[model samples]
Target: MTCARIPTKYGDFQLCYYTNTLDKKEHLAFYMGDVSEADDVLVRIHSECFTGDVLGSRRCDCGEQLDRSLQMIANQGAGVLVYLRQEGRGIGLLQKLRAYNLQDQGHDTVDANLLLGHGADERSYSLAARILEDIGVKSVLLMTNNPLKISALEAEGIKVNKRVPLEAPVNSDNESYLLTKVQRMDHLLQFAPPSKPIKQRAL
Candidate 1:
């Protein structure tokens, strides 16, 4: 495990890089503030989401989660954000876009991927676990709504002390998408109670 100081526009952060034998891949972790010990760390293993993250597409809540995690870690004054480069759930951008095309034809996210000759999710977290170990994080309060992330990290011997949920505001365009995530993807989302209807202003 080797640590290097990475200078970013936001701030200078300590990055720990390491190679994983099991996955045969290299991984990195961006450390914020002081996180030398185990129990005192807050971590977020963020998978890459290009459409929502970079293009601000309303397909899913990826960008929102990323923003929320950054803000949360900044507020905590100490934490690490392990940004894994697993784009499109590890299917890469091309297949992801193809899946999006299928999705536009009324297919669900999972079915679209399956239709495109891909699995439900092609992501792997072994590299993330290795990176965390390299940084000496024994335990962490994981910021995510995905239960699979918690289980994956725990399986790799990284102690997940707690789960910090990141839920975004649901809108008309993304209501069904959110429902699919909660039901199909097994995300931890407590649906907000229906609010009083607001009167529409006349044009």
Candidate 2:
């Protein structure tokens, strides 16, 4: 509905606020440089993660991915980050927190959601595609590990030129979570051997 210029450490961007009839939620488009008709525009379709993105929770890599995507877009000087409001993979915050408790009880991310009677990933890409089209993005070099995102966007008629991997740091807390993404979701990722924990010296 409105566009505003936002200056960040990485670069200045024009943030466009969008209100779509699909979900009628406030989605956003943060773009740097001219993307109105640019080919091979870099794009990242990010779902909202309140805990990870805001509080920097270590249980997942969502915060890192969000920051890394912004940095990458800044470096390119011409990219778009479609911030979708699909919190907790679209199960909403309440269900997500409950699922986290389930995770602590020894369930993987997917299974936790399934236990909550929700799909593994309830997030949709149609809103993201519409936002991209509204922003006039022609084709994109999508930064993601999820092949399903690429397919979903394409299915929604967004031209994906190539896949640009946006991997994040693996930590003790999120190790198994990332593994489930690879093993179950078919995300294109390879895990490095976990770093050994440092032992503290006796005082």
Q: lDDT: which candidate is best?
A: 2
Question: Model 2 misses residue 109 by how many Å?
Answer: 0.6
Encode model 2's per-residue lDDT on 1-203: one tens digit a residue: 89999999898999999986778678999989889988999999999999999999998889999899999998988899999999999999999999999999999999999999999999999989988988889999999999999999999999999999998887778878987887788888765433422222111
Model 1 scores a TM of 0.84
Q: Estimate each model's TM-score.
A: 0.84, 0.93
lDDT of 1 at 61: 80
Pairs in clash, predicted candidate 2: none
Alpha carbon lDDT at 146, candidate 2: 97
- Give model 2's TM-score versus the native structure: 0.93
Q: In the order shown, what is each candidate's alpha-carbon RMSD? A: 4.3, 4.3
lDDT of 2 at 128: 93
